[model samples]
Target: MSDNGHQNVTMITCTAPVNIAVIKYWGKRDEELILPINSSLSVTLHQDQLKTTTTIACSKSFQEDRIWLNGKEEDIRHPRLQSCLREIRRLARKRRNSGSPTSDVTSVSHKVHICSVNNFPTAAGLASSAAGYACLVYTLSQLFGVDGELSVVARQGSGSACRSLYGGFVQWKMGERSNGTDSVAEQVAPESHWPELRVLILVVSAEQKSVGSTSGMHTSVKTSDLLTYRADAVVPSRMEEMIGAIRQRNFAAFGELTMKDSNQFHATCLDTYPPIFYLNNISHKIISLVHRYNQHYGEIRVAYTFDAGPNAVIYTLQEHLPEFLQVVCHFFPPEVNGGEFLKGHPVHSSPLSEELKRAINLEPTAKGIRYIISTKVGPGPCVVEDPDLHLLGADGLPKKNA
Candidate 1:
């Protein structure tokens, strides 16, 4: 189409893992820059459990840049998405002008098409946006041969998503500047640093969250003055303590701080003018069960935290999984109705067939949970080297016409 040849287009695909904040980043000082009010820490989950795979391709034959999310074409006109694309393109242009060896500069300015898919359900409230934005930036940077820190690119996507660029424990530093240029994420420790830690993600319900994290945080910031106390007083001290505990492998201190921070963050959420409900009855019950189980053991064996939804994320030692699962199963068995435990069981059992009885016996009863994902701290975003995995076709466009 343009002066540059259309035959030689470079395509790159990248997969970025999702992260769950331990310290939590609740408020944003600047919406445009994605600057956080307080520094937060998170653990990047394994890609197999929750992740976003994004493919980016550029070619001179295309007319305009476009994006497709979860197989559905999205309006790329959204300001946040546009800001990310424009920033990445600026960096790419800089790299091209510098004649960097790593730059894959095409003779003509080309259009970029991005296609992203999340392995987990969109309704899961599992931080899909974090992985989506991180993967989008990572893939686009590679496609355009941009030479900049991944954290910088990641920050433009989502504040928490920036931490997804690093593996293991990541800390998002809330810089005290108006520009928000210094607010970036850095790795606190590697995944191998704490190999024995295990995470059990309990999917209580995968329904769409009524209040988005962004809107909730904005409300919390505007209404809750306690958030000020947290950002200025509580979090700073707890962050230092948690870092020390993590470094020394002090499970007791780690559990205490983790639970306290989670509670405080949620408290701030409730302190919002109209109040926000991030957790439901099931979530409270799970927390109570975990606390009771730990009290019964006379020591803290597990720690629980929640995000902006009802899902419960439990942290424990690798050796404690069996006991944890047993306790959870005891409390939450599969649902039963009309004496039919599993689905498709006959309503009337006049003769009571042996197979029906056996099936009923095998079927779990009253478990109000969807599923559980077992994972731990994992590595950061990585590029997919195989062309087969790319979401872009040979024409440098989205494979599904997304």
Candidate 2:
């Protein structure tokens, strides 16, 4: 939409979902290209519960490319940020040169104003960068009227951002190419492929981790032998097994692989010289709680995975949600208001059965967890047509008050 008596303000808003890797991506083969050492698979969480909403505007009136994240302006010169912007504009120029772009609403050389915000906590190992970069690239593609094979561009911003390009089950292939063009992500199944499956995010702490993922990965890659072995020997078979499990809807197989892979990934972190401890005391207890709960049922009805943070992401079917949640509430009683503790898709909370209580005989912790966010598999990035929803106003500035 063009502002009155001014150059056209071509703006677009897009939201992208966060993906939790079932088979984690820890090391990068090429840091500049953001290529993973091994392929990893992830479940794209429902955007209604967790997502990054980004608004991008292009105009000749703008002086230079700028960005605002979560209402705070960020340096536009950051390398990864520059990479995404450069790649998208490069694609736009290519389209313009080829006379293939259908929309000339915005010119290739126009400067852009990018504003992005997340519904969840940032830099807390919740994959905020994944969704943030995905939305940024996707929004830019719409603003510049360029599309096709965009996961490659998004990957340059953040390695896992490529996986966020798809819904439900997705895999980031660790391509063999040295230039890293083949290290792209693809959807293994649509969001509708897994309806019964649910994801519960246990927010242990919202504080940013002491070690960032990229830093940890570089340290682990340079120092940890276990990381190398896991990348070469462990992940290939698990990726195949994970794909088959997702296709067949085999919870038992799926849950085991998820937990095992998470464990191995963290082990590699520990093996890093000087070591990196992403999990805390509460994280360990949650892991134990999950094992005891599963042992009680004599089956893997639930699975827990941690991604470079203290938070635990639980996977279970709808049938077991109420019961498992009841168990969680019993052990880690909410210190905050019940309403405040649980967010996202509402679930029925009931008392744990006496029989189940006998099985998981652990002392209760008053507030080991801060809150719970219940979400499920959902679609990938989507454009928002509503002008009111744009994070940036027509003046090429952030609409958010923060």
Candidate 3:
């Protein structure tokens, strides 16, 4: 302990990539706890393409604990965010009292200032929340000189966020307990475990989702009975198969289970009374085209999965990217006119401009999608040690472009 309240002030930053569940986590048992009805598996995307960078700094100069997301100050009073902070603080205090090894000692009573940013669009239904919460917990753990495991803190943020704590293939164990204390994520395998796997994210629409995933899951759990069967029977088997596929490097088995699980998850959503619409017409079109292409190829070359929104995540081998890109380009050509690609004429368009028509060879397709991001499996959270990269200023406020 020193003049800075307790000891030296320190900062820690971390970045984590978003993951798309090949075997989705559809329904929840406890909304507040974010405890899923069944276990789920996901493939962590490369951080260079899609990820969240979070910086957590502890200093006696800070007046109160605060957080900033994408350059905008957020209410730290939000229970979800507060719970994560409290849990990390508790762990840090325990470590400090035990005389544990720490990278940098900070004032024990210092307040934490956190700033986070996402590389991709937040509202595009691309699991931005997962990456955000994951990075927040990971960065805070390092900043507070916290010792012990990191998964527990990550779980308090979001159930899926726990999986993002690990890279490559991860599994969120739906532990058998009334309290979700044991329900955390573990790395099934690393990216190097299966070096050939690749993920191609199709940015269908950048429009904000009408319904959030938390709300949608709540609606499905209350209204849909199909969710019960899927959770009890379908997901358990799928989880087992998915884990085995990853362990043995069985792409064929992996692809089959992935597609089936995604379809079932969406099916349960549709079965919800007054069904919540996630995928639009354009999403279906992409699915149909992918199925047709795979059929023509006469082998299982690609796999597509969607989260709670219309964005499609296609998985394939690194070697097959060129062929896959060539076919995908024909269907979703670049948006040369008005940021819209002409896949076919819109079934109901106000009016098609001549300039728009010429972009896709005057094709009727209504510029079916937004854009495509080609990426693969990425690493776990990392700290940005560069001072210039800090998102918070010396005054404990959000820096520009944070």
Query: Considering every candidate listed, which one attains the maximal TM-score?
Result: 2
- If candidate 2 were superposed on the true structure by all CA atoms, what would the RMSD be? 1.7
Ranking by lDDT: 2, 1, 3
What is the number of residue pairs that collide in model 2? 0
The alpha-carbon deviation from the true structure for residue 138 of candidate 1, after best TM-score superposition, in angstroms, is: 1.1
Off by over 4 Å in 3: 1-9, 101-106, 337-366
Deviation (Å) of 389 in candidate 3? 1.6
Q: Is candidate 1 or candidate 3 better by lDDT?
A: 1
TM-scores of all predicted structures: 0.89, 0.97, 0.89
Model 2 Cα lDDT, one tens digit per residue, 1-402? 356623477888999999999999998888888888999999999999999999888888888889999888899999999999899888888888887738573567888888998989999889999999999999888878888889999999999999999988999999999988888899999999979999999999999999999999999999999999999899999999999999999999999999999999999999999899999998999999999999998999999999999999999999999989888888899998788888999998776788887788888888899999999999999989888998887788897552
Which 10 consecutive positions of candidate 2 have the poorest summed lDDT? 1-10
**Best-matching candidate per lDDT:** 2
lDDT values for all models: 0.79, 0.91, 0.78
lDDT of 3 by residue, 264-351 (tens): 8889889988898889887786677667656765777788888888988888887666666555555566566633432211212243
Error of 1 at 367 (Å): 3.4
